[model samples]
Target: MGSQSEVMHCYEQIAPLTERMLVLARAKQWGELPRLEGQCSSMVERLKDIEPLSTLDEAQSARKYVLLGRISANSSEIVGMIMPQLSKLVGVMKSLDRQRSLHKAYGQPDDAYLP
Candidate 1:
């Protein structure tokens, strides 16, 4: 594990990214979500690497608890916002796949079969 400071710093970094992700999700800015999520994931990976050996002071533990709660809340809200959009996208992809399969089976170009 890293020192208390290192662990705390990772949490601090993750907090704001999660907040931004929530904001982006709320605004329906889907394109930016993955970029911010990737950044947050990297910070979490760093924490995982350094967390095993570190011990937090009382104050640091309290702050860590707060930050984690905030992160969780933000993540939950983001997921709530994204799930509907993801479902719609999955449906569209499945529709496209079915169309492609039908086209292949009948040897028809997609445009020829369009209504």
Candidate 2:
């Protein structure tokens, strides 16, 4: 929980994180996405605890809109790039699981021949 000013400052922080997320996705750093996502979730939760901001001037309001738009665009692009890879990874994992199950049912040792 923080003051209104601090919450507004968080909005500023979110834009850069969104940019970093975009960069990470572009670089295929799938392992890092969850960490950044956790950070984003924390910030959003902080923002949620506070009341809506009503003191922003026109210029600040416009800037907020632009930053939010950028964040949205970055998120969309990241999802687009990651979804296919995620699908493929899931398929591979499912195949491995099926193979393991079949091996268990056959009760064959690791090096045993199976017909």
Candidate 3:
């Protein structure tokens, strides 16, 4: 809360390009990703010297709650921000679960995942 503007400014500077990198990653254009990665890495390096984020001290917690309220109130951007990673993790977990179930049903873990 001490410098909410600073926090938001940093996020603003990096989020667009990070999102672009995510898009290029999804499209599998690995060759074109370096520029975005460099931008993100540069922003991160700038940020690294900052102190860690605060724990939920009352005033800071209240600020965070307000921020979360704004995020939750606006469904589209929050979901867009979160869903791609969520979907990928879900897909990987489901695949692993299916492999597990197959192993349970058929008795061999290796065979369950094998062609």
Candidate 4:
């Protein structure tokens, strides 16, 4: 509530996280899965103003879309404050994806990553 500048800066930070989350969903590393899970309560809170999110996979791109919708709708209420947590979550998820993608790309059929 301090200023619009403050809010927009927060939005900037969250924007990249949304992209990173998209990749995480694609990678499906799923190591720090708690970060995605914990947001359910926050999403529940936003439901009063934001549209109800679909029953999409919680740790996937659809979930990220729901978050972007909420963030766009309630930019003022949420942006500045959620950064640290979301950044940390996305950071770890990215790290996990880097390794997970490699393990997957080079994986043998018996490695359990194959269909």
Candidate 5:
């Protein structure tokens, strides 16, 4: 087991947050995401400010790589969960635009439009 090195600590703090983000994403718990994302972003900034993990020993480097991989996997999963909803939202917006264009082009009754 590696000691509490700065690089290791940073990864430790981030990995669980990534896991939690994945969980929240899966649950569609959007209201909680912004706060958690902010915390993760802050940790990422701190990690970026610190020296790279290349200075760590072999074990620590391996651990860092694993943590980064998990974070990447979790993020990818989160994107997968979000993409479908985003696509649906875009489709609805396009449909609304089409309706607005039709309303403008024709002298149809305003009530004819679907809300």
Candidate 6:
């Protein structure tokens, strides 16, 4: 937003991080996601703070459009990959809750339910 180049540079920096996130997601390296996601979020917050002083020229606009499209696509795919795992986790949590409730109803000791 400071200049056409500065805005474009920010976009340029974000594009690779999104690509890396998509690669990690595809590889099912779930543990690395939060760290990469934090980095991407920080970049996006920086973009939001930028005040547009000038408009992008045709080529820069095109590149920005492409980078945005890639970022969106990669994010969508990552969500798709994560949803099923999240669902399974929710199921496990619900099951644990149910077991806890049943044990309480029966007046069982705290350690009665051993996994």
Winner on lDDT between 5 and 6 is: 6
lDDT of 1 by residue, 12-112 (tens): 99999999888888889889988989999998998888888798989999999999999999999988989999999999999988998999898988787
In candidate 5, which residue ranges exceed 4 Å CA deviation?
1-4, 95-115
Separate clash counts for every candidate: 1, 0, 0, 0, 0, 0
* lDDT (C-alpha, whole model) for all candidates: 0.90, 0.81, 0.59, 0.50, 0.83, 0.85
lDDT string for model 2 (3-35, tens) is 656666778888889899999999998899899
Question: Which candidate number maximizes lDDT?
Answer: 1
lDDT of 3: 0.59
Over 41-113, each residue of candidate 3 has an lDDT whose tens digit, in order, gives 6766754544255233576456655654543444344346457867998999999888888788888866545
lDDT of 5 by residue, 21-102 (tens): 9999999997888888899898888777674533787898899899999999998998899899889999999988888788
Which digits, one per residue and each the tens of the lDDT, describe model 4 over residues 33-76?
34743453444444433333233244544555665775565443
Among all windows of 10 consecutive residues in model 4, the one with the lowest summed lDDT is 48-57
Off by over 4 Å in 2: 51-55, 109-115
> TM-score-based ranking, best first?
1, 6, 2, 5, 3, 4
* Model 4 misplaced stretches (Cα beyond 4 Å): 36-115
Model 4 gets an lDDT of 0.50
lDDT of 1: 0.90
Query: Total backbone clashes of model 2?
Result: 0
Determine which window of 10 residues in candidate 6 has minimal summed lDDT.
45-54
- Superposed by TM-score, candidate 5 places the C-alpha of residue 68 at a distance from the truth, in angstroms, of 1.3
Ranking by lDDT: 1, 6, 5, 2, 3, 4
